[model samples]
Target: MELDDVDWKLLDLLQHDGRMTFTELAKRVSLSAPATTERVRRLEQAGIVTGYAAVVDPQRLGLPIEAIVRVKVRSLDTPRFRERVVALALVRDADHVTGDDCWLLRVVCRSMVELERFVEQAQRYGDTTTSLVFSSHVRNRPLTRAVVEGTAVD
Candidate 1:
């Protein structure tokens, strides 16, 4: 879809505050509420706007320990690993990527013991390397036009 300046502005505003009402969005974009709503609908139809979600802090939720696990699954275990990994509640995010590791997982646990158990279970499928996360400088940063267009200036 060809997004104009208005569409880009809408995306930025929505990303920052998904709960912002259509009327408020219309005011910010200088468009009528109906027009703004229609544009947003089109964006959704085009699959540009996937879905809205609430961001929560794992630390505040009693999940203080965060870790990244790299797993090199055995050739024959890939299918089983994929299914089991998806069922694990400790895994916050998982990515199948290239390199020495076949899968990268972001996980959170209440304690080191819990993390160890998870790692041990993962080791059943393949070799696992885990790293505890001390800090995260960036989480979910909003996307903007310049960034997407490769015209962003540092």
Candidate 2:
């Protein structure tokens, strides 16, 4: 689905506030509620809007610990090596990168005990280290005036 100005505007609004009601989205995009709903529906169908999620504070959830684990897998070409690493729920994100380590996993758990268990399960063929994350600064998607004006974010 080719996105026009309306679609981009909807995305911009939703990016900032995914909880916005369809009626509110309609007003923001200068479209009728039904039209806005249709556009959003199409966007969802086309996979542009994957899904909505509530961004909760890990501290509030009792899972205050956050860390990035560098996993050095012994079996790089093994069939289930990647699969085994990704199966755990604590692993919020995973990526394969070039370097000494084969992959990296971002995990959040309530305590060191939980983290140790998670690590033991995740490290199917690698050594792991759990670092304490004092803080994190995650940048939100830049869907502001710059994107609207098509100046950057290219």
Among the numbered candidates, top lDDT falls to 1
Report the C-alpha displacement of residue 97, candidate 1, in angstroms: 0.3
lDDT of 2 by residue, 83-125 (tens): 6667677888788777887778888899899888877876667
Candidate 2 CA-lDDT value: 0.80
Give a tens-digit lDDT track for model 1, residues 1-154.
8999999999999999999999999999999999999999999999999999999999999999999999999989988998887469989999998999999999999999999999998999999999999999988889989898888886
Reference-based lDDT, residue 122, model 1: 92
Cα-based TM-score, every candidate: 0.96, 0.79
Regions of candidate 2 where Cα sits further than 4 Å from its true position? 76-78, 121-124, 139-154
Compared with the true structure, all predictions reach lDDT values of 0.94, 0.80
Q: Which ten residues in a row have the lowest lDDT in candidate 1?
A: 78-87
